[model samples]
Target: MTGRGATTVWHEENIKRTFEWSAGAIFAIPLNVSCQHFNVSKDEPVRLLAGTNMPHLMNLFHNEDFIFRNPFRFHDRFSNDADYFRHNKRLTVRSWETNLIQDVNAFPLDDYPMKGKGVRIMRFGIAGTTYGCHIQEFPVGSRSTFHRHGPGAIVTVTQGTGFAMVWREGEERRRFEIRPGSIYSPGDLMYHGHFNTGHTTMRHFAMRGRSPKYSQDRYRTPLHDMIPFEEEPPEIHKEYLEELAENGITEAVSVVKE
Candidate 1:
């Protein structure tokens, strides 16, 4: 072969290896990722992201349960590790004392410690499903401080309008307005945050599965933010640039600019 042809072959091989390496950690497909009870075919199209390689590829392969009434389905994760998400036993009738419920902010909870926290959750016997949703209303001109999810959550806007900035912690942030139907199913891990950007109180619905007090694990935490993702721990700054490229935005986010 010509030297130029050999070089081309070598470069192509390198590109292929990068493609495989970049995809991401291999997760053993869990048997029960579906939140629905229906069976799914293994032959269906599945998109497993190459790490943060394909941010647009939201859902992964193998098994899913369709939401009771919606076309969107939740994947069933049957791993022993996944099974231990604690939500049902989280709030017991007796657990409520002092006319309040514990661990729950009491927005609508009659007697929960998380009073005004979000909303009361009804139990779904099938595990790994988020039964309850909560909304934190942000008054006009107030932005939620940078924070990340303690456990994974799926969010939808119920009322009000605002902008949410999602990014790897400390990276360039991308802001999107939360409209009546704006929805996001983010990756299971990583430190991303939001901002409420509107003139009125912003209300949103979030579905968070039961997670152990320490499950998924968190590092540094402040008294106010009850989450695991920290901003000061140091992460890839390039994520911001990648986000900018991925989202097709050309302007820098002035999150810190006055």
Candidate 2:
């Protein structure tokens, strides 16, 4: 704790503290805990990314009080799947303090047709989680269809390279390259598409709400105006080239020749 806040540590018998984190460390914090993050380095900038399953709770109920109270206070008391007992469902808020992926390829992939493209996905293991996360892979030179949904999503690129094109209705398309450790988000209700420009398969881990009923009926594909790979807009092409050059990427493709 710093910057005008009290540096007080709670008296929890089992609490232990350590300050060792690497490049790809994933950590979690329990709900209603007092915690602080600090950057000890003075010359280098520290970037932090955060993810949570709070959306699942929001989708389950609308009461503001539920945020502070336990949602599953009596979860074990009932076996009924009724609406009233939804708050009684099993809920967990703890995760490995220093979780690391031993091997990305060890996980099995499940391929399915989504929005006209075959997508390979592998769900991560996080028991009692309400949010679903998986590693998604796109084969070389393939692209996903233009799709939109109400739930926002964040994808972190882990392997190969690609680019994501995002746009809203009546808005100009924005292109961004998907490099290793790169993160992209399709803002709520924004139509977005992804393309694997690299020669190898592109892999990214995606996080979003797991409940199908959450923001239901908001996912759509406006295929009528979907842009084809061969007919990609000239402005979008120009932006793609600019991003590649800015990021020191030498790989370039000719849309017309493809």
Candidate 3:
């Protein structure tokens, strides 16, 4: 290696050292550190999804590096202290840097009753992670069952047009319109349902924490019956037709029993 080539080699070696020193930290990127990745084999491609507390940190710090060096230092040795994390579950912060990726087609959709036709879900849960997410799809006119779960949910609509309806036990139901750019957070334990009243299929990325309450039971409670393939009562059918016409939706929807 000579001149620029030699400099590049030096830089690469320094970065390798940095990664070694920063190992076991959840997404903590120190100041002046850089990263590089390589594909050593034809085994599989990489899929990366990352979230950070940078936004919240920005609100409190004039210097980003200061926060991590102090309070976040523990993250670097988190794996070595599993007992601390298991005991302080609510206070521990989880972070990950992953290179593993798999084809969505490789995983079969769960046959649970909550899913709808043209609807498929791929759950992504990592060991020791408090947060989990899934990529979900709803084909045209498909809608999910009205259900409630323990953990708060944040959703980013990636395609098509739709709306989500949420309601608490005593509160009136609220509907929020969603599109490709929409980001919605329906808080924990709210009864909610999803509708893709579009001509094309709709997709979204959703996330929630694996909190203690989330594991007490099935995690999901249905508020309404499954979507009906057979003819609904005359009044119910009329209401469905009216909604379809009002929304300029030509696609068919399952007649869900209320």
The lDDT leader among the candidates is 2
Q: What is the C-alpha lDDT of each candidate?
A: 0.34, 0.52, 0.48
Q: What shift in Å separates residue 235 of candidate 3 from its native position after superposition?
A: 8.9
> Where does candidate 1 have its weakest 10-residue lDDT segment?
1-10
RMSD of 3: 11.1
Query: Model 3: which residue pairs collide?
Result: none
Put the candidates in lDDT order, highest first.
Answer: 2, 3, 1
Q: Which parts of model 1 have CA positions greater than 4 angstroms off?
A: 1-132, 149-152, 169-171, 211-258
Error of 1 at 125 (Å): 11
How does residue 184 of candidate 1 score in lDDT?
A: 72
Model 2 CA RMSD to the hidden true structure, in angstroms? 9.8
Model 1, C-alpha of 94: deviation from truth (Å): 16
Best-to-worst order by TM-score is 2, 3, 1
The Cα error of candidate 3 at residue 221, in Å, is 10
Q: What tens-digit string does per-residue lDDT give for candidate 1 at 151-206?
A: 44676654556566665655664666676557775553434444434434445545
Query: Compared to the true structure, candidate 1 yields what TM-score?
Result: 0.35
What tens digits encode model 2's per-residue C-alpha lDDT throughout 28-69? Answer: 333343346555554555565677866656888876696755
Q: 1 or 2: which has the higher lDDT?
A: 2
